[model samples]
Target: MLPRPVVPAAATTGALLLLAACAPTVPVTAAPYATDPVCAAVVLATPDSLGDGLDRVATDAQATTAWGEPRDAVVLRCGVEPLGPTTERCESVTTPNGPTIDWVIVEDDGDWTFTTYGREPAVQLLVPGAVAESRSTSFVDALGPAVARTEQLRQCL
Candidate 1:
């Protein structure tokens, strides 16, 4: 009986990496959606340079998109019915490029849900509380234009 020689682990790992890089693109199914289809186009047309730590994800809905991992993700839902008059902490932010977005903050223990305040077919973003406090400005700064394209039927006074 003869024993076989083993290849070095480093070379084996490199081979795996090369194989993975050559793998075919996997299809991501859309999430179940009940909102307007136009919102999907807005989402699909959004650039990938959203931010430093976020990555676009495929869901089953036309009006919904998600970023980051499923466990703790930032979910954006467009074409939602806008919020009516409320007494919550509604804030307006002007992006660096000069677009203003209105948002109503819904705070939970470790999550902050922000919904566009005065836009038709509003946008709702569910971000982790930590990310909301830290990178929210950056995210909103980038997201303003895209969301604004949907048209505003109202404005925060």
Candidate 2:
């Protein structure tokens, strides 16, 4: 057999680095109550995709997940502190075949953040403007089952 050419150490290192960079992982900060058992259920119940080609992506934090491209992903973080009465826009969402969930809506710079109203270990969703506009309630409805895993103590009146 002919002698094989050996790759240089630097070239091998560079190639490995390039491969590592190609693997996408969305950066997410774990919520304060991330370790709560309820959060585990929420994460487990989350859908693999949010429709419109938004597939689930790996996350760097516990009880956190993201869907869609990293640059414009829809992020979900479980185990946030529960919300008491709030003046923020709240809505009661009833999914077609899932449980009804209450969410407090907040908008910042065209991005929408929705948090479960009164669940002990609340779930938060950071939705990009474009995706929210296109999917509207569909995305939230898709997540209702997961969010519903937590016990809701209050709702929009």
Candidate 3:
């Protein structure tokens, strides 16, 4: 009968070190985005405004496009722009009149959903009828330019 000999600690350690040296290390790059004045103005928007702080505009637009709804009345601001194959950049503000601001860059599959809470009530406008009509128009007015700028940004990339 024969017994196997144990390897010495130094030899085992050297073999392990050699194996570790052969392993690969991958480098991850940063997400693609531009932080210029035009992009920032549109991307870093607040409630009652439209801009690019978020990256889900394209997702919203795709959902909107699929929904086939011209526009959502409940949404104080609606804007969309593309960002590669599986992502989109979006910024929206549902204010005191409407009541919350959401800036997001959703990724892949159009399956994300979450509810947000705010201090103010979720009314489309503080007042109703003609007064609200004026307000809604104002929202569109403020949001339009930002949305347009975002659209141009999508092309830039």
Candidate 4:
């Protein structure tokens, strides 16, 4: 009979701790105004999960967050440059029993990028096609409160 090898409890715990600490960090570029104090408030107010099993992930940049797998993560970056009047499609997303936010939509390669229209230190969300098709406005709704931390200066008209 072969003897079973014993692993030390402390060593096993240390290995588990190391693995837990090694969660992948989502790479995101910090926005030009990422250091703005309002960005912190927005980040702090963001929900831990965006429904549909999409949970917040660690980001490499300030005022940035991601949910779900890196390849198809819903990324949000606070402190993006505020938008001015534009002819692009703008949608006013009103969360259920929550705040209303205006987002200017830009599409590229079947992906949608939504940026806040009226808020200074604006926030931007990159939604992959699959998630957009599956989740629709849930992501935006989940983020409404966080993005609304900054006052709205205008509305989609």
Tens digits of lDDT, candidate 3, 99-124: 23333333234223211111111111
Clashing pairs in 1: 30-59, 30-60, 31-59, 31-60, 31-61, 32-60
- RMSD (Å) per prediction: 7.9, 4.5, 18.6, 3.8
The alpha-carbon deviation from the true structure for residue 114 of candidate 1, after best TM-score superposition, in angstroms, is 1.0
Put down candidate 1 lDDT per residue, 78-113, tens digits, no spaces.
776678988899888787866788888888997887
Off by over 4 Å in 2: 1-22, 133-137
> How does candidate 3 fare on TM-score?
0.22
Candidate 3: stretches off by over 4 Å: 28-157
lDDT for each residue of candidate 2 in 66-120, tens digit (9 for 90 to 100): 9998878899999888888999999888888779999999998879999999887
Give the per-residue Cα lDDT of candidate 1 at 65.
71
Considering TM-score, which of the candidate structures 2 and 3 is the better prediction for this target?
2
| Global lDDT of model 1 | 0.70
Q: Distance from true position, residue 89, model 2, in Å? A: 0.8
Q: How far is 92's C-alpha from truth in model 1 (Å)? A: 1.6
Global lDDT of each model? 0.70, 0.88, 0.30, 0.89
List the candidates ranked by TM-score, beginning with the highest: 4, 2, 1, 3
Alpha-carbon deviation at 123 in model 3, angstroms: 34
